[model samples]
Each structure stands twice: as C-alpha cells, then as structure tokens.
Target chain A: MRLSTKFSDTIHLLAFLQVYSDIKLTSAVIAASIQTSPVVVRRLVGALKNAGFIDNDPKNHNPRIAIDPKDITLLDIYLITEGHTPLFVIDKETNPLCRVGGNIQPVLTNIYGEAEQAALTVLNSKTMQDIIDSLIVHNKVKQAKEKSDLAQDA
Target chain B: MRLSTKFSDTIHLLAFLQVYSDIKLTSAVIAASIQTSPVVVRRLVGALKNAGFIDNDPKNHNPRIAIDPKDITLLDIYLITEGHTPLFVIDKETNPLCRVGGNIQPVLTNIYGEAEQAALTVLNSKTMQDIIDSLIVHNKVKQAKEKSDLAQDA
Candidate 1:
C-alpha cells in the first residue's frame, strides 16, 4: 500500500498558511499550491482547524495557522495525523499455548513503542518555523540558480 | 491501508527457529506458532533465507537463522520489510510558482529522512537476541503470574 500523504499535506497547508498569510486563504488556493483538489485541501484544513492548529472555518473562508509557527512541531501535526497509529503491527493470531507465540506480541509492542517514540522525538524537535525557514532557504537557492542560468543565456 | 506484520512475523520465525533448534523446522510448524497459514510462513522464511539471514531451502527443509542473533538488528528485518519504503510521503505535484509549494517537497523530504533515521537508530540498537531476551523475560513474568493465580484458585 502507498504511504498516506495526509501528514505531509497538512504540514504543507500550515506552511502555506504561514508563508502566504497575506492572501485571503481558501481551500482552492491551498489546493493549487499543493497541486491536489480543493476537496482534499479542505479536508486537511478541516482536520487541522478542528484540532485548533489552524483558525478559520473550512467553508472556503479565511484560514491561517492559529498557533505560533515556532510552537507547532511536526509531532503536533503528526499526533493528529499519523503518530497515534502503531508503526509496527504484530501478528495477533499466534498460538497462545506456544511460548514464542504467547510472548512475542508484548515484546514487539514494547520495541515498536520505543522506536516510534524515537521518531516522534525527532518530529517534536522541529517547529513549523524550522520548516518554513528551510523552505525559504531552498527557494532562495533555486532563485539564485535560475538567475545564473538567465545571466548565462543573456 | 494496514501496516504489514511481515517484519514481526519474520522475527518470530527466527526466534522460534533458534529456540526450537532441536526440533526439525517446517513451514507448517512455524505457521502453527504464528497462527497463520503454512504458505505465509514459507513466504517469510523464503525472504529471510534468500537474504542470507536464515539457512536451508524454504521448501520445508531444515530452516534455521544463519546469522548470529546478536548481530541481526531490528533494522536488518525492517530494511527488507518496511524500511526501504519511505515512512512519509510528499506532495510532488505542488505548484512551483508558489514558494511553499515549490520547495516544500525537498524540505519535507529532508525532515522525513531525519525522522526515519532516528527511528531506524532505535531499531538498529536492538538485535534479534534482544528481542528473544525480552520474549523470555515476558514469558517468565507470565508463567509466574499464572502459577500464583493457580495457587490462589486451588
């Protein structure tokens, strides 16, 4: 199965909200930026909006991230999107009479928990500002490269 | 939609092989422990065996883990199972005219790489022996609890 892009889409929505806060936000506009349908964008915005991460109604009204960009971590978005689900799944149909089968689930559960926590810690370490800052840096680099190509063409 | 348990099942298969080494290994026997079909067990065994992590032909021959348990990390299993696929997905169809959409994919890609590496680090920290050890510990705890409960009932 393809990995769901819901988490990344939501992050993009938030970053879009922050980067273009001057424009009156609509699902269509954000969807255009995401290159997905407005329906998908509205749904994502609705999730973040209901979770209080973003402010504004989802009926194509003005939308913006409600929280400080610095305060919103990837974990903050992830918790609402994907982090609540277990990363690793254990086989539940194992024979309880067998020692290995009987005890494997809990052992796996503990290790999966630790691994997910480590991943979440990394997600929590970065703020929305970090994402936006990185975005700006990449944008600038691309622009500079474009300018050099244009100068060479001239 | 659902996360695959292929990795966990492989781990269980290997642990069972190592623990029950005296017993002849068969896919049906492994399936019985995993509470799944022999076909499923064979598929898992085939993967591990082909990867050089386990020994023996997967046609119900004497199958056993080939590597040292302590040397085989969870990452080793995950790499063949889920780790090779990205844990996160980016919206690649984003509009390049917009700064957020234009540069979001690469920025998110970098961040996702970091988060996955952190999770992988935790998975790599634990060897197959660690999983088996935890299983044994959990088994002892359960056995003790069961005995205490039987005495109370008696």
Candidate 2:
C-alpha cells in the first residue's frame, strides 16, 4: 500500500509550473517549495522533460510547462513517473512445486495490468485545469467556513 | 508506483486456499508457498479473517476460506488490505507561500480517490475463480509447448 512519493511530487511540480507560468522556476526553488532536495527535483524534472511535459532550457536551467494545463491530465504525469513502475512485484522465490505458486505470476501480472489501465482511464479523464479548479473551490469553501466561524464568535 | 506486496501475497494465499480446500493450511505452509515470512502471512491472515474473507479456528490454528471463491474478487482482497491504505500521500511541509503547494494536497487526494475507485471497479469485475481458470489455461499451454519441444528433441 505504501507507494513512493514520486507521483505526488510530480503533480506538485506540474501544478506549480501551471500556476506560476509567468515566473522563471529553477530546481532549487522547486525543491524549496516542495521541501525536497534539489537533486530529486532535478531528477523528476528530467523525467518530465523526457515525457514532453516540461521544457528545461540548458542555457537558463529554468523549467517551464511544455503542454497546456488544460491538455495535461494527472494520469499523464502518473504514467510518466510511477506508472512506468509495476504496481506490485511478484515474489521471486515462490515455491515452484505448488500449483498456485508456479503459475500465479502471469495471472497476477495480467490482473495488475487491467487494474492499472482502469486507474489510468479515470486519471486520463481529468485534466490539470480540473485539479486547479477543484483546488480553487476548496479554498473558497475553507474561507467561507472560517468566515462563518468568526461571525458566530462575534 | 512501488506498492507493498501484501495484495499480491493475499491473492496467492487465497488462490492456494481455493485450489487446495481439502488441506488444513497453516501460516508456515502459506508463507513457504508465498516465499514470505510466517509472521507476514499470519498478519495478513488476521486481516483476512477479520474482514470475513477467511476463517482461522483458534483450536486448530488452521485457516480456511469463509467465502466462496466465485463470490470473492481481487477488489474484495484489495479493499481489505492495500485499499485501506491511501494510494498517495501529500507532502505536509510544502511551502505555504506557493499557491499550488498550499492547495495541491486536497486536489491530489480527490484525484487519487477517483482513480482508486475506478481500479476497484475493474478488480471487482474479476473473481478468484476467473484467476484460477486463467492459471489452468496457462498451465495447459505451457505443458503443451513443452510436450511439442520434447517430441522434436526425440
């Protein structure tokens, strides 16, 4: 159940890029914002660049969004990073003598693939803009709740 | 994308149970077949038992399937184990000054929930019998290929 923080960090980076499209952002700045190491940010930035999600100019060392926020989906980022890795790893030393153990790998692999595809389908349906809009709505709701609480106290 | 092997191991254990329903299975035996520690198997067995997926008689210390294999889906096992855990975690220390960093957690949580639900839907569509049937098919194909190779060698 424990997954690497790569996907979460990737989305954080992409959302940051979208929100601050006007600002020139560096890995160090991103690392600072994400509270992660610059090396980690640089590594993920490399992946994003390779996936055609971001543009990291060699001359400036500044990274920018390459795809439109409306065009990019969370699933797109998930595939580029975590999606490249298998969801679960089959045990390498399962007892071959057991009928289930001998053939479980292929069965599990097929099932995992189908499950991952289903997840990807859902993620593909949602764009970065959709995430941002939801965030905006959440922020408004929070502000309204706080305002209501403050008024009740008065 | 690296997830814990609990789900895979759970399926392995369940499929073994279905295939060998006559045998009184112990954690040690299950662990041996799964290539995992007995402690790990015991822990998962506890979860499965608590979730009403399996029965562990205290007097015998042996486990048995409580539900019909045809009635149990991978999604049921997923829900009892890995599905209880969050698919992704948000960075708690993200820089609050950054707009996206400040608001990304809720947005990401929402998206992860939807994606997980979609995956669960797919998994729910497949039962343990389906996996066992596929495994049987695979074994036959493998045996047939081996027989053909042996014929050519002879």
How many clashes does the backbone of model 1 have? 0
Pairs in steric clash, model 2? none
lDDT of 1 by residue, B19-116 (tens): 88877777888899998999998888878877899887355458878889999999999998776667667767889899998899899999999988
Candidate 2: Cα lDDT at A149: 100
Query: Per-residue error at B110 for model 1, in Å?
Result: 1.2
lDDT per residue (tens digit) for residues A51-131 in model 2? 888886465546877878899988788778777566555666688767888888888888888887888888899987887
lDDT by residue (A12-33, candidate 1, tens digit) is: 8898888887777877888888
Give each candidate's fraction of reference contacts reproduced: 0.82, 0.73
> What is the Å distance of residue B102 in model 2 from its true position?
2.0
| Number of the predicted model whose DockQ against the real structure is largest | 1
- Candidate 1: segments with Cα more than 4 A from true spot: A57-61, B57-61
Cα lDDT for residue A140, candidate 2: 77
The CAPRI category of model 1 is: medium
Deviation from native of the Cα of residue B104 in model 1, angstroms: 0.7
- Grade the docking of candidate 2: medium
